[model samples]
Target: MKPLVMRIVFWSVLVAALAILAGVVYEQYGRYRAARDFPAPGKMVDIGGGRRIQLDCRGAGSPTVVFEDGLSIDGSLSWAAVQPAVAQRTRACSYSRAGLMWSDASNAPRSAKQVAQDLREALMRAGERGPFVLVGQSLGGLYATTFTRYFGSEVAGLVLVDPSHPDQVARVAAFMTETRSLRSRIAVSLAWTGLLRAAAPSLLPQAPNQTEHDAQAVRAFAPKSMVTQMAEGDATDAVLAEAGAFRDLGSRPLVVLTAMAPYTGSELRGMQITPEQGVQVQAIWEKMHEEMAAWSSRSAHRLLPKAGHDIQFDDPRAVVEAVLSVVEAVRAEGGTPPG
Candidate 1:
């Protein structure tokens, strides 16, 4: 009976639908444009089964240093500050896991063991020879250890940068493996809708030292990052437990770096961590890194009080020193890295 009102409602719904469709189209176009602007910086090696991994290597030397990135971050981007320095001393490689930027997604689960195999395969196929020095940070630490466990002969040394302990699930049950937050969920939704890429700032305030190209690439590929990060959250508990299965590194020289800074208000906000809980978590984290240092008889536990969790970004010197130190130890052990 209310034809006029019904017509208005119908038109409103049509207009809204049209607007959303237009935004979606625009977002796709933007992603294509960004990819063109910042293409893959390294070689995309096929790891069989129609899937490929991005492996970017630099410098020239032996005992190749391979970097494993922390949760959700682009592998190479995380090492922007540290890798170049390490590369100057020896060969350095950074790679993206499946579903991450430039790497083809896989149907396989994102477990530590799986990631290790994927890496080994990629390196082997790409002819990136080993007697490799593995450097891992945060979640990457687990994958690095697992890789060594499965392929010990090739791994000559290890440098763990604020690495996550395998037992962290029990130590900090509240937030150890739970990475999904209210903010992340919101970001994921926005990313899929293309709103995130659209709303991204012209400059990345997070990493001021980054180049303009890097900043633009971050904004463009952020949507893919959000989804991959969420998938990784699902595998955290499994990777932790799996990596914990190996405890001893025998005589392999190990260096465990721990950042002593407590969680800031901003960081705590992102993790939804309370101030009191942050203190407890911090204490537990330090102890975990200490225990990891004992994995090798020749291990050193270096504590950087001024640095935060992302020590590479905050203190590139510390990371560079640790990695180069491990490389020196490996050379002292008399292992020649095959190229």
Candidate 2:
């Protein structure tokens, strides 16, 4: 009986190992195929050290507008709804940061300072000359703010959509302890190992009107993308610290879009928290947005009662109008339009 039990256990372990190996192989092949077939829709510009970043630009006008993504979002896809409309009036561009989407992964630290520097270099290489109007969503707000500090003269305006405040981590630490909880860690581990992708691909966010090409791209890079995003999240404090080094924007035209719906605990997936805690989170969030709006003397803090965190998806028109306002303001300030 003992010998038979040992054999059963050994065979079970072997089968499990083989299944995991197969999943890894399948995921790797899918990634390779996606990279070859769906390639970047825009140009790939070398940033240095043989690493390239993907950039997509549209329209023609001066004081070009550059869109930056929130945490984990592909820059190109996130701005799909707003970019076209903005492009109609002025040059609008978006690019994938290193390690996300088609951009080459970098060994550099995933902090805001490094990201800002890479973006500056990519812009110069891509010939998207600025004095740019920088539009940043969520965590991209941190990067945009850092960029202004590093290259103040090149930025003509700023627009933040549900921007992440530097003080956010500390502000909500009590309720957001789950960020470092065991369950969170396990989820990330599964993602890194491709188990999540194999078991439940739909758990990942899908782009609107997702095509077969887009699906392939997501399947191919989801694991790497999650890793990159996690790294960035881990480095949030460092990024916020770097952001503290910048001087306030004296009178730069700025627009801060704040989502009106308060958190109701429903947004936290797979995590349990009280409704009261959720209300507290929402209050802190709104306060942070308000504080960010105060960064510029000419800033406008617009509360979108109907929109959620993803204002671009929920209300593309609002984003377009906010950007248009900034562009018009910049032009009125006598900034030259791109030829």
Candidate 3:
């Protein structure tokens, strides 16, 4: 009886050891997969701070148009309709901000102002002579407006696609877990981290790579870049506060496109937005349109009935039309339309 008990204990220990070893192997494999599948971006430029931004430059003409992505995505190629359409009339560019898709990592804070400043430098260094029409989506809209405010006359026009209001910084802050509710915030953060870890094992590419080649393409694109910039302590609120003051943005011919429908996708399926809250946000945007119209007689709003936040993706035609309209409006205003 004593011998049998000892043998059973030994077997249990061996099985536990094997399980531990398997966990280690799985972790290593997950990391390997992430590194191998990073996105392949075109045209890289080192803009100081040991960081490089990936850019896509094409077309040629006056009133060059620059496209900016949303929170954590960078696929300029995705702007198939608008880029080509506008490029026919003027120089055009679409690029990934640092940490998205094919761009290099940067320790810089991801504020709208910082992004706008980086864009200016990129244009200068890249020899993209302005009279530029800056176009941005979502948070990119904040950057676009901020860019116009900072650059002033250098920018001829501005376009915003359902931009996040500076006021939204307050809303998001009130809800974000870190400042308001630590437990909830930590839980949310842990869930995101765990999801990535689990997906990393089977989601990434088999072979390791120098550039981002992981199945978690969004992760490879955003993790290192945005976290350092926008995800820092109440930074989003600070950026939005600065964005709230739009006195300087009034100088340019601005166009605002709004999405009227509710988000129904898997990502926002269970998001809790009270009916009153939805009405209030919509009202605020409507008021913003009125402010925009008052800001410039030429500033107008176009509603996209079936589109979501990423209007560029959901309704590229609408995006293209808005851009083209701006180009034409600027020309009509004698604002030096792109040649």
Best lDDT goes to which candidate? 1
Report the lDDT tens digits of candidate 2 across residue range 1-339. 999999999999999998888877876776777678878877999988999999999999887999999986454677877998999999999988998878888998677878899999999988878879999999888789888887888888999999988777788888876354565457667764567566445665565444555556665666667667777778877877777676376688999998876553557543356767776787888898888888888889998988878888778899999999999999998873221
**Model 3 misplacement above 4 A:** 1-39, 75-81, 169-234, 265-271, 275-280, 337-339
lDDT of 3 by residue, 297-330 (tens): 4577888878777677678788888988887777
The local lDDT score (0 to 100) that residue 39 gets in candidate 1 is 85
By the TM-score metric, which is better: model 2 or model 3? 2
Candidate 1 weakest lDDT stretch, 10 residues: 202-211
User: Which pairs clash (backbone N, Cα, C closer than 3 Å) in model 1?
Assistant: none
Clashing residue pairs in candidate 2 are 61-338, 62-337, 62-338
lDDT leaderboard ranking: 1, 2, 3
TM-score of 3: 0.73
Every model's TM-score = 0.93, 0.89, 0.73
